[model samples]
Structures are given as C-alpha cells and as structure tokens.
Target: METQDSHVNSDETKDPGAATYGNFINYYTFNPPENRLGLIPEALLENLGLDSGDEPVLMLDVGCNSGDLSVALYKHLLGKNASGSKLHLLGFDLDQDLILRAEASNPFPRNIQFIPLDITDDAESQICLSSYLEKHKRSRFHLCTCFAVTMWVHLNHGDTGFKSLLARLASLSDYLLLEAQPWKCYRSAARRLRKLGRSDFDHFKALEIRGDMAAHAGQHLEKHCSMELMQSFGNTSWDRSLLLFRRR
Candidate 1:
C-alpha cells in the first residue's frame, strides 16, 4: 500500500483569515483534562469483533484540531491491545495550520496522518477521503469521531446543512461518536451575532432549529438515517453530550 505524507513545514506565522476561528494552538494546549474527548478503543474493538485481529482497524477523526484527541485515542488503543492488531488513524480538519501542527506534533508518523479538507464540501470531502482510502486499500471506516463541529455547521448552514453532513458521515463509518451541543449554545452564538450587528436567528428561523438543538439532531439521525443510539455521555461543564450511534 502506498502512503502519502500531507505534512508541510510552514513558517509559524498566523494567517489573519484564521483569526476568526480563534487560536487553535492555544485551545489545544490549554484544553482542560476534564473536557478531553477520549474514545474507548477497547469498546470499539469488542463491538466490531476485531478483538482477534484479522486486519488493521481504520478510524477517522473529523474536525480533529491539533490532533491531540486523535493521538490520545491511538495511544489508548495500542495500550489496551498490543497484539497483532494495527490501528490506522486519519484526522481531517479545515484549518491548514492545525493540520500542519498536528502532523508536526505526531510522534507516530506512520500510524496516523492529518489531512486538511473541508468535509462540508461534499465533492471535496469525497475526493480527498476516497483518494486516501484507495491509497491505503481500506474499504470503510470502522469508527469515526466528530466533536465540537456540528454546532458550527448548524449555526452557519442551518438544520438541513447539519443533517446533510451527518448523512455523508454515515456513509463513511459503521460506528459514529458525535458530540451534540444544546440549544443554549446556539442562543449564545446568536447573542454574539447580535453584538456584531448581524441577524441572529435567520438560519434558525429558516431551518426551524428551535428548542433543544441536541434532541433535534438526535431525532433527525434516528428518523432519517436509521441510526440507533447505543450510549450517551454528558459533560456538564461544557453543556454537551457525546452520543454513540450504530447503523441499523
């Protein structure tokens, strides 16, 4: 199998365009341990029946900023099972700087790769992901993790936009780990928009994304995509819930 290195060593100058997204490096470096979004690789291994180890486990981490969480998951997986089982982690992020930083900081260069691509763009996402899969000779993703990303899409593109993204994700992985933000967060974002003299509820009004944003997303996934919620974990400090879903 052919492996492509997507890491680029650029001058550590911050791009002005990326300022609106906040400081990615500081966020990852200063992220609280309590808020760490850790994935249970053993649970995934047992659930997928890959415990005996037939082939390498292919995992995707969407919106993986700075790749800290991806590294943690990879380490946990290897720590739990040091047998013949192999883990291949692919992390995708829209920020080029974050991708660069992730690649630079990654200790296990061969086991993990970071790609800079906007998953919201269907054609671009498909092409980039498909090319990677083809290069690696993988059929489908065994597990996929999406954290702290859907709410942004929901705020910017509305409910339909978020659902479309979810559908695309479903096609890529059999098991999904999603973090759902509540309506309060959306309202808080609206408040920020109002402060900036921008219309706050336009997307919400258009998509009817009112009341319990988290529940709305969960319901949509269950009804439209036939995804069953296996388990849910909550972080009261962040006011978010991590939901585990399996295709039915």
Candidate 2:
C-alpha cells in the first residue's frame, strides 16, 4: 500500500513529544468508518476480559490519536454490558489541539477522560504514569496496548527505547498488544527513494542505521529480530499473537 509522502519536516512532524495530541491531523482529517481506531479498542476489551457492570479498568491508549481507540474501547464495553458501569479510559498524546478536538467530539463514555502526556522521556514519564496506576489500584487494568507507537521509540532510541517501552507495558498490563512495521520495509523504502533521488537515505538512517533505518539513528542501533520473535508470541502460536503475561 502506498502511504502519503509527507513534506513536513520529520523533526517537526514526527516529533515523539508531539504525540501528546493528534498528529494524524498533519496527515488526514477526522472522519469515520475508514479509521482503524475502533478495531483496537474492541480487540483490547475482548483480550482484557473487561465487560459491563464491573468497575471500569484503567486503560491507557498510548499514542492515542483523536481518541478513536479510546472511543472504540468504550463502545466495546457499552455493547457487551449495558449495565452502565463507569470506564476510566485515559488517552495521552502530545498535541493539545488533538485533545481538544477529541473532547469536542465527546465520543467518550461519561467515565472516560483524556490527558496530555509526553512519552519521549521514559524515566520522568513512568514516574507520573505509575502514580496514576497506584491511585487506581482497585481498577487493575486488564489490558494495555500500544498500537503503531513503537515506531517512535525504535526510531529515536533504537533498541533501548523498545526495551524501555516493553518494561513499562509489562508493569501496567495483564495482557499486552504491540505492533510495529517491519524494519526491512523502512530500509527498502529508503534505499529505493535514495536511488530515485527523491530524498536522502541519510535522514532515515539517522534514526536507525541497520534495521528499518527510517526513524531512529543517533543512539546505538541494531536489529533484534522483533517481527520474527513477536510473531510466535501467544500460546496457540498465532502470527499476531496477544501475549498474555501474568503480573510477576
């Protein structure tokens, strides 16, 4: 599938810090039926065993864009259990405008809320996020899923970012779902683009030198064979397996 070639400066447009809000606006307007946000929320709720009547779980849709994922989760809960149980779904993004738009849409259930968070710095970000989890200990999250967000870490911090993100997700979830584009796609695209003189591959390599090499470059770089490893994750050995890890 051909993706839009964004002319905006990657440094500005792809800023991990900017994810606090809606970054997709830079690419597309907010419209329905075509967006994939609904799929994630439904899948997450099913995976987490969250249903109606129970106290809402503390769901964190990291890299939530325009709150579609959050809406999807709520919709799933509403559909499964019309008992009107409250849901405490918090979405974090870098852009305030996106947050406002999400609020304006008001797609959340009465119990849901959205917040702005900068995930670029793990140490500080975790301290804050963990605090919320602590206060809401009664509502242990059944699920924590980061969709299309790992690319930011892999692009900026390379494997280090990936590991840090994994550690955090492990702390907050009973089940987790993480997805990423194959590194080779980025590498191949960069090579092809450079050959055609469209853009310098150096920009892509700066984020990741050997792997996808499209996003992360400055920090130490290496390929971890993640796409291969994550493919065999779940008990049944499904390709895109949902890793069910109990809290240790």
Candidate 3:
C-alpha cells in the first residue's frame, strides 16, 4: 500500500483531467451529495431487511467519492435502526486523495471507514473486503451501493469486465443498489478525455455491450448472478437509473 504522502503527491490528485478511470479528483464539486441524496427515499431503504436482522448491519459503498454520500447514507440509516442493531459502513475508491479527504472529515470514524482500493483487482479486493467481513463475523454485506460506476469499468475493461463486475457485486451482498451510467454518459466521458488531449479509453470504441446499460446490468444480474431486480428507484439528475437487486 502506498503511504498517504506518496498517494496524495501524485499529479493525478491535483488534476481532474489526468484521471484515467473516471475517478475525478474533485468529483463532488459539480455533483453535490445533497442532489443524489434527494433522489433516495427513506422507505426504499427500510424495505431492504437491514433493520430486521438481529445481527449487525453492514453496508458497502463502492466508488465513494470523498465519502460524502456514504456518511450521509450512514446517518440516514442510523435513524432507521430501531432494533438497536449496530451498523457499519465500508466505503472504498481507487482515488487515494479522495479517501484522505473522507478520512479527515469523518465525524463517525469508528463505524464509517474509507479506504483506497481498486475493486477490479481480484486478489487484492478479495483479501481487503473479505478481511473487513471477517472482523464483523459476517460473510457478506447486507447491502452494497454502487453509484454511477459501471460505465468507467465497462469503458476501461470492455464487455467481459462489465459482466464480471455484476457477478462479483452480487456475490458480495444480498442486495445491490446500483446506479449505472447511461450510454450517453459513456460518450461524454470519452469526449472529455479527447478534449483534454488524453488518450481515449482503450475499450470504449471496441465494447460490445452498448445502450441501456442499466437494463443490461439488470439482465446480467438476473440471468447469470442468481439475482432478481427488486425495484427501480427511477433516474437521477444525470438520467442514470438506480436499480436495486436481491440475491435469489
């Protein structure tokens, strides 16, 4: 693992245009957490069996940019825990500088943790995520929330990688609340890189999976991952769909 000094010192942390995998350094400045929070209803979370379990409730936040939404969601759920069940949330992203900011501003450091991890790294992710599960005496998280991350993974790794990500997320949690970026967003990201004079995403042009990515994700999770779509919480400001799935 790179030290804080080494991670934050990188040029990528200082410049958003340099980011390769859509992990923008200053992500929340343009898209505030409050806007995203407004779309999620409290009733949607209460129906997920989180508060019903006798054991501790665990939530995983993938691509938690600066941990703002993770902290907000944690506080939201904190109010729903009428059973007095202990709740813990683990948020991770590939950007280390963002993780540093998250850690610094964290008011509930004991229950909410932010780490720098690349979920695409199979061995490392398994070890790190599994270790967190082990410490809580659990095998999988109760719920996993991934907001607007699928496009970057798909554009970078191609069609196969996108399928693998869906399978992996399904295996890690009983419920997955996903917000997949639409096809237009992919085009936008690619165009941004080109405008910045950076090389295009390698797999973007070659990707076989195209159009209605959220629906595609839902199909893959249902057919290949033994998961079924439980609900669709509708689209966000960017027109991305928040689809919730449950392991069958």
Per-candidate TM-scores read 0.80, 0.62, 0.89
User: Rank order by lDDT, top first?
Assistant: 3, 1, 2
Off by over 4 Å in 2: 1-22, 26-48, 80-83, 138-140, 188-248
Candidate 2 minimal-lDDT segment of 10 residues: 217-226
Stretches off by above 4 angstroms in model 1 are 1-23, 37-42, 80-85, 193-205
Candidate 3 Cα deviation (angstroms), residue 113: 0.7
Highest TM-score: give the candidate number. 3
Better of 1 and 3 by TM-score: 3
Candidate ranking under TM-score, highest first, comes to 3, 1, 2
Model 2, range 1-248, lDDT digits (tens) per residue? 00122232354243322221114554333234224433343454544456545555666767665676567656665675533455567677666666666677765446666666667666676777777777777434566656556545554455566656666665566555554444654554444444444544333455533543222311111132222122223321111223233443
- Among the numbered candidates, top lDDT falls to 3
* Candidate 2 local distance difference test against the native: 0.49
Q: What is the RMSD of candidate 1?
A: 6.0
Q: Which is the better candidate, 1 or 2, if ranked by TM-score? A: 1
Question: Can you list the residue pairs that collide in candidate 3?
Answer: none
Global lDDT of each candidate: 0.68, 0.49, 0.79
Q: What is the lDDT of residue 140 in candidate 1?
A: 62
lDDT of 3 by residue, 1-248 (tens): 11223333244444433356766555676666766677677655567756665677889999897888888877766664533337788999887887888999987887888999988888999999999999989899999999877877888788988998899899999999999888887887787677667689899889888988888999999999999998887777767778888999
Local lDDT at 157 for model 3: 80
- Which regions of candidate 3 deviate over 4 angstroms? 1-18, 80-85
lDDT of 1 by residue, 90-153 (tens): 9988877778888999978877889887777889989889887777687568888887677667
